[model samples]
Target chain A: MNKKEQRDHWLARPATVKRIWRVFVALLALTVLAQLAVSIKGYFGLDGWLGFGAAFGFLSCLVMVLFAKGLGYLLKRREDYYGGKEEPADDV
Target chain B: MMFEPIPPALALLLGGALIGILRGHARSAIVLLAPLATLWLVWQVPDGVALDIKFLDYRIEPLEGSPVRRLFATAFALMALVGGLFAYRQAKWHELAAAHIYAAGAIGVCFAGDLITLFIFWELMALFSTVVVWCGGGPAARAAGIRYVIMHLLGGVILKVGIEGIAVHTGSIDVQPMLASNFDAAMILIGILINAAAPPVSAWLSDSYPESSPTGSVFLSAFTTKTAVLALILLFPGEPLLIGIGLFMVMYGIIYALLENNIRRILAFSIVNQVGFMVCAVGIGTEMAINGAAAHAFAHIIYKALLFMSAGVVVYRTGLNRCSDVGGLFRTMPLTAICGIVGALAISGFPLTSGFTTKTLISQAAANEAMVLVYFLLAAASAGVFLHAGIKFPWFVFFQRDSGLRPKDAPWNMAAAMLVFAFLCVLLGVAPELLYRFLPYPVDYEAYAPDKVLFYLQLLLFSGLAFFLFLPLMRRTRTISLDADWLWRVLLSGVARGAYGALGWIGARLAKALMRIGNRLRAVAARHMSTSPDGRRSGVFARAWPIGTTALWIAILLTSYVFVYYL
Candidate 1:
């Protein structure tokens, strides 16, 4: 198959969707477990140490989705961000 | 008896000439060996005056005895080795050749005991690295390279002026700590800050590095700013302006990296951010803070180069650099993915990374000093690091939604280089002593106490938490963030055009006025010359009679002179 057909086939595969879902769930579970661990650790008077971490991990994923575009804007350049012709000659 | 250390200047001169003579793989071999030899020589140098010379009636000491200088020189030499290895397979022979020369320049700066030697190597670095950037071999790379050269050359000129002024005033060229209170010292500070990618000119790092070839970026990231940090440490340690400058660079790097989309550009911005930490540490100027700066520079070179190498692998394999075009490569390129993540985690200052060991000392020092605002800003900047580079880079490049590209794993050499650095990052993190011993200050800070590690993890993770909770607010992409350099690159370019246009208009008007005045003068002169006693020609000399009237006038003048003298 050509490149387009191959790409379409891959995208349409149920396995691909399932793998993506698995990743999402795994991330979620990891975040939740970390939060719980931090809280439990905090109960033993270690709140200053672990609480912020659990919270930050959860927050990073959330922010990745929320500010995905804004973050993307900051990091994104034109495909040829470094490419372009010199400015036109000025008559003046 | 007197002892002398191996002169770093000799190494640079010899290595640069040798590399110029070699070809292809031989060039890479020479480049790799040069730094190692320099490192060995640096170690062999005894703790005494190394080399001193007299130039232009001033005593120029180009090599001095100092543990701090030794540490920075060691790092630069190591950077050349690994950076050479990473670039060996793919880069052009000329690039490899020039890069070694560039590395030699950096080493020269690090080992420079005085300002004059530092200035010589400083311009050499600017020249050679611009060549490396131009090695990308495209219109964009060429244009950016020219702009890059112009900026650095301007910086070099400023530095030279500052050095000369200081020498004239102080009668010595010995490199010493300077406070930014007077013209000469302030000029030096401004000059050094420019190379450090300080605000107003910070855009050059991001603007040019991404234009470099994949391997080129790895080499590009290591030298320029770090050399400036070395200079700052040597010349302006404890100056308060550095504190503000460092903080500005830290936030500026993060915010811009957040908005940047190119994989390499984000890494480039993080270079600025990481250097900011060192600058701040230098400004603090305590033993702990200086030690932190030294250790952090050592760690940063390895990990940042690792991060760039992994990204280079991706770009090399698939020819994709934009985040929007890349995703989910973790499925196939697992090694690159893992290495990239390791680099990300290290940069984020995760518990078992090199950053954890080095970065903490600076914050701890600030806290000890009771500088509450600085402490808070640095903490927030640490969070911002996580939000921008740590999470943002890996997420978009490796773990975001699949873009369905099945590139092969990184080449064996690339993998080997990455693995070495990745292991080093962890090794340094876990065993800070290996690096601490090389620091200028004796190590007293503990990196692994339970309370400190736990506190750091919580602080960084909450920043991560903030990132996720506000993901909706961060959705924008594919745009360039404005930086202080925009004042010159964009806004000033516009202003320059307007000024030129106004000047042109005014010049045209002035020329026309002058021409009109000349025409009127000529008309009256012509009218008078043409008229005689009654509107006819008065004499031939007035209009067309040349020889006869000249003779008559000369005779009249001689007679008049004789008459006047007789009277």
Candidate 2:
């Protein structure tokens, strides 16, 4: 298959959709749970901000992964980041 | 407690030497026995008993006892045991020999009563560990071993200077907390930081670690960096710079790990990340935070070594270290895959794992201190841990689109090591008190309340969500991300080349000028020395005639002077 066809095939797969939905629900549930936990723990004289911290942490990771490609553009090197002759040209 | 006459440090050094002198299975036997003996000695030391000696009008306490020291000493002993088991089967005789010496160095550092002893053992650790790396036996391993030696030698020098300065200034060599404002303390902190794989020298870890023999990496992962963490907790707790430096390490490790394709390299970066939590905790410097750092180091050695063991097994069985070259091995190496996943989960700080039990105390300490920025950065780092190491490692190595290679499960010894650590990880997570009894602080910290568990589970599970949601961004294959060490390895190499080229250009010009001058001198000398029977300088005697005449005249003058004096 051509590159475009391969990309389209992957994006359109049912597994892809299922994976996306699973992640989303899991994230939402986690955020709500963290918020509740932090509030309750805070009331009991445990650290209060944990729930918010957890929620914030989860959100940021999502954002980072979402933008990882762009970030990779800046940070990623040729697979030959070491600039050695042994590095395969197409590996990256 | 009765004060022991024998020094633990001396015993360790002697044990290490004895192990090196032995051969075959005797080597492993000595390795195991030495640590057990050292552990016994460490446990026997009473609280507040210190071995004090006066030198150069300065008081030096080279041995001090506290719960913290005991905790670190215990971990080092545990590491020696497990690391010995993992390496005993596959390693060369010298690797086994060097491994004992290396473990001795670590144990010595734990019992080190003062900066002097600590520094001595610290350099010893560097020296012997380099020997372990060299045992991998390849050109790459050789080059890596050189770089590793250079980095550590530099660290040792800095530490020595710091120790001497503290001795001169304070008239005491006791290892105690020092403010970062003190130059001696700062020097010591930087020195230790370098060993801890903190930036900008962090590349030494990933560079040398993967190049080590599969068996050697297990030993490589345990000692040097974690010992540095132990030192930091003892000396630099509450230093604010550590907070920022550690946070940078956390994200840097995660990002680099995300970009890496080698299974072992991924684990190496994760070491930096795990140590970051300890460093941050030390910076917080609360009792709870210090407790967290100690607990985390204990848990980290077990889980991280387990992770490396799993990766080593894969590489050993299949002869591949790159993720692209490895996949579908779960079909055959199911046990290794499961253990690897367990390690990944524990490392990610999933609830009901050792990491969850230990890592949260540091985060809670930060939140309690109201360091919002640190709290956020650490939280983000937590998620990144899941992204790079948690999901990414297992997903690519074991479950990624099958590369259709099946290797047998790890050897029985390797399986035994992995299982032992995997069991410890869960056991500690589920029943933290087993490990808690060994912490530096009282066992008041709770790792698994409902709310806390729920919060972490949600955070990590969602982080996993983020990973899949951006699957397009997380594609893996063969690659390595350049880190700060690139400045030394790459940028410095380029600069050196530029300098060499400039020097070559200058040397060519200088050589041409010298050649012309030399020819002129040669012609002049030939004209004078030509043998035309009357040339200025013909034979060897002719050339020497002027010197001979001068000598004769001087002799006549001396005779005249003697005659005049007699008259």
Candidate with best TM-score: 2
Per-model lDDT: 0.78, 0.80
Among all candidates shown, the one with the greatest lDDT = 2
| Tens digit per residue, CA lDDT, model 2, B168-273 | 8887787788877988888899899999999989999988888888888888899999999999988898988888888878877887787787888889999999
Quote model 1's TM-score.
Answer: 0.84
**Native-to-model Cα distance after best TM-score fit, residue B3 in candidate 2, in Å:** 7.2
- Candidate 2 residue pairs that clash: B62-B113, B63-B113
Q: Write the per-residue lDDT of candidate 2 for residues A3-92, one digit (tens) a residue.
A: 644554353345775897777787666667556535546422433564554555567886666555556666667665664422211210
Q: For residues B1-567, write the lDDT of model 1, one tens digit per residue.
A: 255566754664576677778776676677678767877877776565577787878667777768888787787777777777777778776787778778878878877778888898899899999989998767778888998999999998888888989988987787888898999888888889889999878888997888788888888999999999988988988998888889888877877777676788889999999999999988998888888888888889888998998998888887776887898888788899899888888888888899888888888888777777777677667777888888888878886667889899988888988998999999999898888888887888878876566656666665665665575566535556656666776678889999999999999999999999999998777666655556555533366666887899999999999999999
Candidate RMSDs in order: 5.5, 5.7
DockQ of each: 0.20, 0.25
Kindly report which residue stretches of model 1 are placed more than 4 angstroms away from their true locations once superposed: A1-92, B1-4, B514-567
In model 2, the runs with Cα more than 4 Å from the true position are A1-55, A66-68, A78-92, B1-25, B50-62, B525-567
**DockQ of the two-chain complex in candidate 1:** 0.20
- Please report how far candidate 1 places residue B528 from its true position, in Å: 7.6
